[model samples]
Target: MKKITFSLACLLIATIGSAQQDTYVPKKTNFFSDVMFGGGLGLNFGNEFTNISVSPTALKPITENFAVGLGAQFNYLKSKGYYESTSYGVNILTTFNPIEMVQLSAELEQLRVNNKIYYPATYVSNDFWNTALFLGAGYTNQNVTVGVRYNVLYKDSNLVYNQAWMPFIRVFF
Candidate 1:
């Protein structure tokens, strides 16, 4: 009789403890409250070659460790008397932070490339669309990220570059 009563008493206490730990509902979140703005700037100069680019991005975190964003890019390149080109594009990017100091990212970009090439005695114009998918990993510190990215869609016939790799630094505020 005593054992039965003790079991019932313990069960009642357990139920009350669980009831006291009920979760509370959180306040509503605003869409822009956590948005971040950032961008990357690029410049390359040589005796006969110059390249400049600007990109602006907006990112929003949907979870503690993941974010998604969109960006726009404008690029201009000139190799004196050889070629002059202008590129404009839009991209979508995603980032995942597995740890506090590491970030992994992916971006899909599409660009319209317009070029003027000067031969010995003639000029040729070419216009086309180029697409690239870049995958990267970086060390992140504060608002800065430094990394190397690989273009998985790079082609030898692409007019922009001969290599498929690029190094980058990104900042956000």
Candidate 2:
């Protein structure tokens, strides 16, 4: 009789202890909340140079560790000798997270640019298309990310060289 009662007491204690520990099963989350928004901004000024840039992006999480997105970019510049210029581009971006805090990113962009150059007597408009591939690494947290990107195809002394490396910050809402 003691043996049977002891076994029942043990079983009851086990059940009560298991019930006391809360097993957190996360609720189903909405797709829209799972979506993240982020982008980068840039500004520079000097005696003969001024530059401004804006780029905004939206990302859809494919899984906990990967995401794909699209972004639009715009840039404006004015220099002492060179005429003011405007450039715009569209980019496709992908990011992969190997760990919670580290991210790897890539972007393919095509930009259409307009610049003015001195001709024999007057300034003439020069137009060109530039393609750039950017790769980067970043640190990320729950609501913010900071990273640096390098243009693999950057060319020195090239009008297309807006910047060779860019640091970026993104905030998610």
Candidate 3:
């Protein structure tokens, strides 16, 4: 009788403990008003040439770790002649904070680029980069966060199948 009673007590305690430890649910936050701005540089190597790009982005938090933002990129090439391109896009981002200083995020971006040629009057309206999907993981300190992202380009008719290991740093206010 004592053993049965002790088992029942243990079961009850376990149930109560589990009930107290509920999973986290994210809360909705304001947009535009609570926005963050940051930028980064990346090196892109292609079949044609290698170049560097400067990208600036804005992030508006929708929840504790979820945000949506816009980014603009300016790329300069240094081989096989000189060319430049400008890209603009929007991304929906979700950040998961599993630990105190670790964060994981996934971003879906829709991007468009305007390609320009330096020599002669050469420009194409439809020579644009397509939408891309990316996933990233990073570590964050008090005010700065750095991460790497893998970008997959969906449409490749006009552009090459390009993949980039992009590192970004963001400042939160």
**What TM-score do all the candidates reach, one by one?**
0.79, 0.70, 0.53
Give candidate 2 misplaced runs (Cα > 4 Å).
Answer: 1-33, 42-50, 118-121
Pairwise lDDT winner, candidates 1 and 2: 1
Better of 1 and 3 by TM-score: 1
Q: Write the per-residue lDDT of candidate 1 for residues 1-173, one digit (tens) a residue.
A: 99999999999999999999958988788898889999978899999999999999999998999999999999999999999999999999999999989999999999999999999999999999999999999999988999999999999988866688988787888
The C-alpha RMSD in Å for every predicted model, in order, reads 6.3, 6.1, 11.7
Candidate 1 lDDT for residue 162: 69
17-125, model 2: which lDDT tens digit per residue?
9999989988988877777777778899999999999988889889888998888999998886767788999999898999999888898999999888765568888
Native-vs-model 2 lDDT? 0.87
Task: Give the clashing pairs for model 1.
Answer: none
Q: Please give the clash total of every predicted structure, in order.
A: 0, 0, 0
Best by lDDT: 1
Please, what is the whole-model Cα lDDT of each candidate in the order they appear? 0.93, 0.87, 0.67
Which rank order by TM-score, best down to worst?
Answer: 1, 2, 3
